[model samples]
Target: MNTANPQLEGLYLALAAMNRLMVEKQLLTHEEIHETLAETEAAVMKNSALDGQSDSHRKAVAFPIRLLMTANEAAERGGEPTFEDLARQVGRTS
Candidate 1:
């Protein structure tokens, strides 16, 4: 397990708690939570790259960040948030 970043660990913990809470409240099915978590983790990992890049590359990177923000918002609202939802919200459609 990587513990190099406390903030990332904290986010993982918070996401776990959210999953438990959603399950307890019946806001999300167990499978749905599991899938969402997996997708979220992948998205976070992909966006973790911070290589120096051109302005165009940075602009492209913003797409994932925006999708993540939308996903977080939807999760907070107890909505049935999924990777598809995030993609659609960000106009990525994928």
Candidate 2:
């Protein structure tokens, strides 16, 4: 797949792997990750609005949180989903 930046793709992979390990190690539950990401997304969206950021900007800023949330959801479902899978889900559910 094409990406604007390769570094960003690497970052996403690293983050997803960390999240999976965290869940697997029982360091943090999926519910906790989901809740935290939800709260973060809300805060980012609100800040974006208050700062008069564009809709696209808001979505861009929230992308990582949404990706993590998607990963957590997939983990909760007992599936080792790919970054692409989580990314697609994030796009669909955004």
Candidate 3:
């Protein structure tokens, strides 16, 4: 969790915040977001396979997917999950 670049961390926070706002405004349901994230993740993984991408590359690409999925899960559980906490969960889950 050594974030050598601050912008990467900012992007993660921004994504999580955007998802939270969308759910809060009822523009998108938590279930909808979760389903979409799952689909996206599957597609990314499939493409990675086809392209013969390295495991490190695949995991790096999956970070945002995991971040969004974690955000949606936190929304469903009525919990405010931090970016660091979500990032840690993503690593463990991955």
TM agreement with the true structure for every prediction: 0.37, 0.88, 0.90
- Highest lDDT model number: 3
Candidate 3 lDDT over residue span 15-35, tens digit each: 878888988898998888899
- Steric clash count of candidate 1: 0
lDDT tens digits, residues 1-94, model 1? 2246556535544564566577679897666754675576456445654454554554454554455455555655676555545556667433
By TM-score, who's the top model here? Answer: 3
Tens digits of per-residue lDDT for model 2, 21-65: 898899988888888889999999999999999998999999988
> Is 1 or 3 the stronger prediction by TM-score?
3
Pairs of colliding residues, candidate 1: none
Q: Which stretches of candidate 2 lie over 4 Å from their true place?
A: none
Task: Pull out the clashing pairs in model 2.
Answer: none
Clashes of 2: 0
lDDT of 2 at 13: 74
- Show how many residue pairs clash in every candidate, following the order shown: 0, 0, 0
TM-score of structure candidate 3: 0.90
